[model samples]
Target: MSGKRYRLQKTERLQLKIKLLVAHGSNCWWCEEPFSPDDWPTFEHVNPLSLGGTWSFENLRLTHESCNEMRANHYPISYEVK
Candidate 1:
């Protein structure tokens, strides 16, 4: 597979991971606001996955698209879990 195709596959799998989390509760963990599947969510890293947060529930969170983008590659900002 081409590098681009591989990346797309990885992205799809990552999206599936996010979907599983959202299906249980399609809302922002911190803000407690519902998020539609089509609304676009951020696959937030609880402890900066690179810093070692797993793909498990405890280490993931769903947030607004913009919120996630703002946090890209940055340490998680403190947010209350509702």
Candidate 2:
């Protein structure tokens, strides 16, 4: 298979974000801090996409843009939704 990764559509991202917010609240999954107006919220893959993670909701999370960047593509030892 080609190495190209599938990108989520804008609408699909928005829908997933809404579902994440409802299921896990408006807090950063990595930092556990509430998103501020100035903070950019982003979808994070619990299992890094580089490590073969999928775009499904079960593997996604809402986190601050900074947190996601800091995390990069490192796979965590354990993950639990709060």
TM-score leader:
2
RMSD in Å for all candidates: 6.0, 4.8
Which ten-residue region of model 1 has the weakest summed lDDT? 1-10
lDDT of 2 by residue, 11-66 (tens): 97787788899999988988899998799589888878889987877888889887
Summarize candidate 1's per-residue lDDT along 15-45 as a digit string, tens digits: 7555656565777655667777677566666
Each prediction's TM-score against the native?
0.50, 0.83
| Residue 21, candidate 1: C-alpha displacement in angstroms | 3.7
Candidate 1 clash pair list: none
